[model samples]
Target: MQRETTGLLSPGTHVVEVDGLSQRYHVYGSGPVCLAVPGGPGVIWESLRTPALEEFLTMVYVEPLGTGGAQRLSSHPHGYTRERYARNLLGLLDALSLPRAYLLGHSHGGFVAQYFALRHPDRLSGLVLFGSAPVTGPEHMAEAGARVQEFVERNEGQPELPRVLAGLQAVGGATDDEQITAALRDLLPAYLAHYWAREHEFKAWRETLTCTYISGLDEDLTPDTVDDRDALPSLGVPTLVVVGRYDVICGPRWAQELNDLIPGSRLVVLENSGHLAHVEEPEQFAAAIRDFVTETSV
Candidate 1:
């Protein structure tokens, strides 16, 4: 089930086979093992790397199916449901000979993490939901629209704002990798609390950021919607909900609701960050994860 990994805790990329598909997971740092699932359902794993946390935790960055070098399904751009991702997570855990491990999912991956936690509570020691929400569909879209409007108001006079707006509009219609990546890079600014102010710091990340186009539909052509509010209260795993205060997609509102829904779950809001807290405020983000792991692992 596992191959090309010289050692369990060795640093670097490790390959494992799951369901006849080769899944690669990169290993970094030392301490508790934590699987870091990147967001977007198609964003490359490198974008979610947290060097700060790697100092104290063994960060296993997952190369989720349909992204990076991982094999795509016959129904690629479709059938990438949360259930499917969760199954892959389980397979990865088993392939690694890990009975349980901490999981941190960002954005869309957070949705997958929640589904995994709900279904396989015994397989996770802890859970981290970053830039995530408890549901999706029209309501979620409405909220995101409102937040985008707020972002527009805040940066009203900027010349580049129109490009960002165009990117947002293009997202819904993007049907290929190039289009999605362009749109994503165009809208990257809004993902940060302050982008133009620190463009130099994130320009490279944006330029290198790549994504595959996933239709957000199942093989049956059914929309893979989610609503976990009713079920979260029953989740028994330790949870840490991290969010960026200015995150337009999944901001404090969703994080707060998640905290409220999951009993005993902790919430951490990075005041100076938007969607990418780990990048915007590494120290604080790392500290929150370190503290949560320290406190909950006891």
Candidate 2:
């Protein structure tokens, strides 16, 4: 089996050259192949690890370019657009000699997954858009701001809330790795359903979180905006849209919209989770994907 694809699926971490850059990926579990794209665009791949999901599926965790161990583009942070990321995913699939596979994208990674499904439908057996939306930019930002306000209202008197709010404020201007990592850590509490209530459970994870700073721009420094509303209706790949009820960024609204847009896409709302459903509600998250994969696999 290892010789069949040159060890791409043999387990552990593997580095494959894709488009002249080192594309690093980690493999785990042992079932139908499923590529997991981490959200950050700039966040470390480790942050998106789903140990529970790993139990049922062959999890191929992607180390997106410009972050973690993956090689950066000549354009560095500027050109790490969804299209570029989608293409890199294609390269990784081809490198692994996979004709098709299940794809699960979290947060920003969800954007890449949907775009990939639209552009290369023939290469996917199922698509899971986790904590994702159909668009980005002003409208998206507006909705996120409103959701953040709700979060603030829900936890007004909590002492840690201020720091979380500060972190949210810092996100837009963070220009380097250190700054971004700090901001992510600060804002993380707000990303959860009840951070203060369960600090002991996740404090270590927060302390160890790391990220890069990818400017959401093209090589020319123009914003790489996304609006897939029109294109989504045309997507033929079977899709599963999962979102946490408390997710401040891409909350239920966006997930519902995604479900409405994509034909035959199933939706799952993690009632007790925030942004990181896989972490907050691992069993439910894994179950949703496991069922989707089982039903969709040929």
Candidate 3:
């Protein structure tokens, strides 16, 4: 796979200044609006860039705070909280003069989406949660940790993946930036159903994933205090909950919980994917969004 082309990677972006902070989002395609909120708290939406979704809707990727020069100006200790992220998203819409738009969030971004839907149900036409969880911070981390243990136990031969991932905890990666990235690479396979079968997608993602300012933003982006377990079902908006069959992090457990809690929500398990279903199955992923947006736009 020749990866030199930057067709979808590069897109025109418009930055909106709110409260002395700049919120930037890469805009692509032209159609009904769909805001793409990325995960990793610190990881920018650039990591999840895919052109397929743009084909169906005008895609706007909202960068997480402290990314792409959009530095955070907040003095709050929980500056990276999900509430802040959701507000920033709403601010982006206001800046762009969009009354409402479709919201698609992956992993941690999914948490932000939930809060946004809960906080401002009138501002959303539809919602998509891809490989995301609906649990509190402690439960969220426990779920991930427990699944990691299960992954190691279930996969008999891949003893080295977890071992290398453990080394990421030491000072070597802490002091050296490249080591941190390399260690993250070692953990990528666990997010895929079959590493060897879809190594190309993982390799391509690894080459592009970068941790910038607010590197530890993921530390505070969890549902620390914004658990919407009971509130989600009342959002009363069309929702799509998607997960990869082998996504250990946000596996079937989270998917079922989301589907069960959100009334009239559609759950789709991408049979051949892991954490990055959009990367593994972009066409199908994009199609699902298209159909949902279309069905709900009446």
Candidate 4:
């Protein structure tokens, strides 16, 4: 029943084709499973790949529909919804013979994780919500505007500061994919607690990841994730919500909401981190996940 090769048994990344769609999963490590979902909804696995966590857990970096190597089966606008994303996660688990595994969702991926927890709680051993939120649309747009203004005020010397601010406002209302990607580049600096000014590192990262904006995904993400005030608290799954103290995108306020709502979820706010805590503060990030997985697996 397995085409050319669907499940594991390789060192490099591989694809799982089932029911007219293919999901690319980058597998690492050899212990407890942590199905780590990358943010950006379409960003490369590289951004969310954790070498540190792999030392303690089997990390499965998933590329959701419309991102990286993933291919969506349906062209219907409704096909790209959050529930569809959750279904793919569930399908991947079944294809791998993984009855259940830890779900770690970062940024927008956390939204997908939350939906998965709601629909398929029985298939999750635990859940990790990293640098994510409970509600994001107009409020998220407002947050981005505020953050950009704050940074632009102090960084007037940077020639592109004004342009970045313009781009921030533009990305939210972006109609086409090109505008969205350009806006993503303009707003990139705000997500970093460190290396925001490190031109070399920033440039290299931008070059490699580019402006990973997947068309139609913005529609899929924004409108669907309404307030989770009632849903999160009811979740019986063990949960961990990790955030960066300086991450204005998801921010501490949103993280607090998640921790408070998710009954027994543990919250870890790294002192020296922003949007990408796993990259910004690897040691602490890995340690927290290691401890949680160990305790929960027991």
Best by lDDT: 1
Backbone clash total, candidate 1: 0
Model 1: how far residue 102 lies from native, Å: 0.4
lDDT of 2 at 38: 85
Would you list the C-alpha lDDT of every candidate in the order shown?
A: 0.92, 0.91, 0.73, 0.76
Higher-ranked by TM-score: 2 or 3: 2
Put down candidate 3 lDDT per residue, 1-298, tens digits, no spaces. 2122133223586666755577777888777888888875556577678799878688888887765456664543235777678878887777777778899898878988998898888998999998888875678667877776766666667656655347434312343345545555666667777775656646777666764333333344432554678887787878999898878778889999999999999999888787888887888877877888888987
Clashes of 2: 0
Indicate whether candidate 3 or candidate 4 has the larger TM-score.
4
Worst 10 residues of 3 by lDDT: 1-10
Clashing pairs in 4: none
Give the clashing residue pairs of candidate 1, or none.
none
Q: Give lDDT tens digits, candidate 2, residues 116-217.
A: 999999999999999999999999999999999999999989988889999999989999999999999999988999888999999999999999999999
**Model 2 segments more than 4 A misplaced:** 1-3
lDDT per residue (tens digit) for residues 1-298 in model 1: 3333337558998777889887888999988899999998799999999999999888999989999788899999899999989999998888877888999999999999999999999999899999999999899999999999999999999999999999999999999888999999999999999999998999998999999888889999999998999999999999999999999999888999999999899999999999999999999999999999999789
The TM-score of predicted model 2 comes to: 0.98
